[model samples]
Target: MSWTKKVLRINLTAGTCSPEPLNMEWVEQFLGQRGLATKYLTEEVPPTTDALSPENTMYMITGPLTGTMASTAGRYSVVTKSPLTGAVACSNSGGFFGNEMKCAGWDMVILEGKSPSPVYISINDDKAEILPADEIWGKSVWEADEWLHTKHQDPQLRVAAIGVSGEKGVLYSAIMNDLHRAAGRSGVGTVMGSKNVKAVVIRGSKGVDVQDPKAFFDATNAGKKILAENPVTGEGLPALGTQVLMNVINEMGAMPTNNWKDSVFEGASKISGEAMLEPRDSDGKANLTRNGACFACTIACQRVSTIDPEHFSVQNRDDLHPSYHANSGGLEYEAAWALGSDTGVDDIDALTYAQFVCNEQGLDPISLGSTIAAAMEMYEEGFITKEDTDGIELNFGNAEAMIKCTELVALGEGFGAELGQGSSRFCAKHGHPELSMTVRGQEFPAYDPRGIQGMGLGFATSNRGACHLRGYTVASEVLGIPIKTDPLETEGKAGLQIAFQNATAAFDSAGICIFTSFAWSLEDVAPQLNAACEGEWTPERLGEIGERIWNLERLYNDAAGQGASADKLPPRLTEEAVKTGPAAGKVNGLATMLPEYYAERGWSPEGDVTADTKARLGL
Candidate 1:
């Protein structure tokens, strides 16, 4: 009853929009959102299809729980082949835009083929149209966002668009929505831009309905109560956001500093969550203004922030958007660590400004910062010169240089154009692929694998390239969620990584924020799905569904030429030992854990899913 049971298929090649019945069979097998979309993609698009070519397809979809009373139900995913990783890409985001699509009578929107001209798709309830985007074609997302709002005169419309980075094929470009929230990873936006489509705007009045409303309300309320009672969800997140991990990770010696040259950063505390609250000497204003939340999210981990107007980054710049003078919910732990510690820049305001530019221009800050750090190493080694960087001095601890590089990449010009190729391509082009701290051509996130042993395995085997979210062992290895594990030990970590990966896939498919997993498990989620969706869903079944989704993505990637052989950490993480902190003189034990991980997944010793696995999952 919660499902709209409808899909809107927009064929850009034909310039037509048509409605189709949702495939209930696939939904029954894969659930919804990320899982269901991946099922559709594998069935329709070939694994070897060029990611940015017209043969590829993109799906913007929501789950059955979306637009309902379920907390954090306003979630969606963009699923496609990634130009960055050349693997399966499913980037999830939180915002009202997802719920809006459900209200407009679509469970999923499939975008395929390339447009003859730049255009945008507009939807008002059931009415959908392809409209020329001539006036706003070359504009930034913010500029086009304003123009669309003015053109439609609909303040309530939800807009999801790409910036120049996406338009110009920055390899790690993102698709941003509701201004700050992003489906941010693996170049999904590059595929969107290659299709010559500018944006997707929608507005709807049809509210969602649920079967057994009383049970749905009761289950969701119980879920919310659990979140409110948990320390991580109720207190830590709402107060400091994910940035709370900055000091914690640094103290544990798990923070990647200077692009994994070390495991500890001296300036970690200066740019941490606590520091975000400290009043700056320049204007007596703190970097963080307050905390915010996505639609239906009680956790409220978003950081609404601002930069010092008098700071050199924004000083006397008139060619900037007025919004840049004030920033939005930016500078979370990943962005801060990537642009701050990894780049050796401790300037919190400068990091905030870089984060704002990332949000505005739809660039993946993790990849951007890691790439810049690699370039800094190259520069220090005399492998790169000032002439190669368009005259900007490339150095660690230089906030101005970091800010300049971020601006250039956002616009995809000059040296920024080179950096836009992502760390893998950029490093390889400079004849130093070893300098790139990446897995499967995608840059690693903030966590240093040498310090967080399970994360090393997690990063190595992630289906979407190097990412923390796919399997976050930190919850157990650090915060003691469900159970505490030793971060430095590699024993029993293969099982831990498998459990996290499978469970995370389920959460991503169920139209909920992965942060909710901090407090709730599949046992807690089963009741809500059982009540709102048409069929019964148990915790056991949900776990199996999660496994099915994982293997499904893996199978696709295998055919795409990214498989078990691709399970690897950068040499720096696997070979180089940390210099200080709890993990001093220790490197990640990836070699020991990888074989166990493969065995635990029921895959062959070579890491391929066995015939029995395919039969069990009915793939």
Candidate 2:
């Protein structure tokens, strides 16, 4: 069997750790990672339990393919009930940590109950312990990582930890790992903080094994070749990172700018992937230093970028690590758009600074910056004044304010406390919920759903609130991956969203980066899975597994009281049309597409999974 077939259960309240065999029956039904974690959470924790209470459970899980040489197999998920949306939260991450967990001879780590004091979980092969984390309790992820490495005296140990934002109960706080990668979104980190758990460190040298080694190697090699040859996966992503989409989406007029007030940013190219490669006049060095990759990844799309030494964000900050002065993970399209364009701050270095702060402090830059942008708009409209902003000019295009707000939010300071609640709550608290451009209390990402119609449905119906990676129809709509669809039309979006959503769920559960899906589909994935595991894994079965995971999450959300009714876009998305763009006259046609989406999903018009459908899926 490919499975280690073991789970590590840690009870922080009791200060005890135990090992148990995984429920193989549930594994067969739910697959792994997001799916399996949800199954565990649903069975162990009540849906009605407060998301931050001791009763809520946090599951860190890896899929069957994790730790293997298969491309992008180093993925893991943090699954729990979300304080932000009051729904099932499953945030997936990619780094060295997931593979490390698998190499530690376990499939998952289930953390339950609250610790009386802050502690960090440490695992070395089969030995596991919860250590006092007094020194690093209030530290940033970067600080905690450094401390853990120095104290453990293990340079290879992988660490995943929350920052002060998480410790302070920031609703959109993320669990950051390997420095820049994050289990980002839905307040999973907040739940970790609530448990008084500061970090998880793993050092495992034991390698993963497959059922059929020869066949597994062949299949993975073939899949990698496909990724290496495809334009989006090969040329575009590796060359430009996701920042390649900055200019493309902006040209298509789908870029959400100035708090979604416009569908275009005039300065898009200045902060684009192409621009990152251009030499700056000050030092004659490009922003992007090089592209990096995770373990066993053939497609190296990660950006390593450097800020100008004289730039305001980095100036007079010698306490900052040398890596800040050199190069680290740079801005991707989403970060650039959310932190730069959306806030009307076109300064690339400022966005990079904000992104670095997010990575260091374990905050979701998308939600944090977008919420700040909403606050800025409210400030400009006189809905909120300088008094409300603590005398800071919370205005669009204010790079200083943007940087200040980012630091404040990261550290969970004064005005940051109010901003920590996220845009929906922040806006609602200030009497203008409509100004918050979000769906289900989660902030919207870079894409304007109005321009990309399929993404509209994807965002509104996403299981973990508004998230792009959940569906990401942009591959089909914008990049023409698999098949091209007219982005401005809603005609076939329902089926398209369902197709993408299901496929994405499978990708998430399989412990591979979804970025691999840019080139490889289930057809490519089935072979690797089939060769590695015990069962006959086919494309059809993978599709069903994806659907099963989707329905499972929906079932959990329904029981949590965030039913089909909660699957909705904010009023702005439905009522406000894109005033200027290729999709000039379009507002989201969610009304027309939603029922069609339900019918296509084999669910009721109200979005409930029907009995017949449940029976069909063995749910």
Candidate 3:
């Protein structure tokens, strides 16, 4: 069997840690990571439990392909009820943590109950303990990481931790790992903090083994070859990182700007990936430093960037980490858009500074920046005053305000507290919930739904919340991957969204980066999974597993009270027309698409997975 067939269960309330054999029956059906973890969660925790209560559980899981030589194999997921949306939350992340868990001979770690005092989990191979974490309780992720390494006296320990934002209960707080990558969105880190768990430090020298070594190697090697030869995976991503889409999307007039009041940014070129490579007049250096890779990923699409040393945001801050002075995970497209274009701030240096704060504070930059943008719009429209904003001019394109607000949100002080609650709560508090560019209490990503009809349906139906990664139709709508579809057309989009959503679920559960799907399909993934696990994992079987996992999460959300009513976008998206660009006079066709999408998925018109559908999937 591919699974070490083991799970580590930690009850911080009782201060007890135990290891149990994995359920082979579940493994045979659920696969792993997102799918298998959800099965465990659905079985153990009641769907109606408070997301932040001790009764709720968190699962950090890896798939069978994790820790292997498969392309983009280093991935893990944090699964829990989201404090932000009260929906089933599964935030996938990449770094060294998943590989470490696999190397430690465990497929998953289940955290239950609350710790009375601050604590951190330290796993050294088979030994796991909840150690006192008082020293790093209120520190930033960077600070906590350093303290953990010093306390452990091990340079190789991989640490995933929260920061001040999480400790302060920022509704979109993220769980940051490797100092940069994160299980970002839906307040997973807030839930972690509510449990008084500060960090998870792990070290493992052991490696993972699969069911069929030779077949595994062969399958993984072939998958890698496919990725290496694909244009999007091998060339575009490596050359420009995710930010490559900035200019393209902007040119298409689909880049959401100024809290979605506009569909295009006036300064898009200034913040595009191409702009990052241009030498700045200030120091004759480009903003982009280099590209990076997660553990074992041959395709290094991660951007490593540096703000101008003399920029106003970092000027005279000599005490900053050396990595900040140089380069780290830079502005991916989503971050750049949300923190840059969405806020009407095209200053790349300023956006980079905000990105750095998100990494350090463990906040979802998308939610944080989008909420701030909404506040900016509110301020400009006289809906809010200086008294509400602590005298800061919360105006669009105010780079200084953007930088200051990011710092305040990182510390969860002043207006930042309101912004920390996320756009849904922030906008509702000010009597302008319609202004919030969100769906199901989660902020929208870069794409303007009016410009890309498929994404509108995808965002509306996403199980967790409005998110791009849930079902990225931009690949087909914009990049012409697999097939080209008219971005403005509502027809055929229902089947498209369902297909993308199901395929993405499979990738998310497989312990590999979904970016690999730019080239590799389920057919490519099936061989590796079959070689690693004891099962007849064909491409068709993988597709079915994906559908089953999607239905399971939908059921959990339905029971959690986020039912069909939540499958919707804000009124602004459906009523307000895009005033300019190619999508001018166009509004999100959600009304026309939702019913069609439900029909295509075998879900009821109310968006519930039908009993017949469940029986068909054996869920």
Across 162-229, the per-residue lDDT of candidate 2 in tens digits comes to 99999999999999999989898998999999999999999988888899999998999999899989
lDDT of 2: 0.90
**What ranges in model 3 sit over 4 Å off?**
none
In candidate 2, clashing pairs total: 0
Clash counts for all predictions: 0, 0, 0
lDDT of 1 by residue, 1-619 (tens): 8899999999999999999999999998899999999999999999999999999999999988898868889999999999999999999999889999998889999999999999999999999999998888778888888999999999999999988999898999999898898999999888989999889999988988888899999999999999999999999999999999999999999888887898888999999999999998888998889999998999999999888888888889888888778757668999999999999999988998889999888888999999999999999888899999999889999999999999999999999999999999988988999999888899999888788899999999999999999999999998898899999999999999999999999999999999999999999999999889788898988899999999999999999999988999888887888989999989999999988998999999999999999999998
* lDDT measured at residue 21 in model 3 versus the true structure, 0 to 100: 91
Assess every candidate by TM-score: 0.99, 0.99, 0.99
- Look at candidate 1 and tell me the lDDT of residue 213: 90
Cα lDDT, all candidates = 0.92, 0.90, 0.90
Q: How would you order the candidates by lDDT, starting with the best?
A: 1, 2, 3
- Kindly give the stretch of ten consecutive residues in candidate 1 with the minimal lDDT sum: 321-330
For candidate 3, write residues 324-344 as lDDT tens digits: 777767987888999999999
Candidate 1 accuracy as lDDT = 0.92
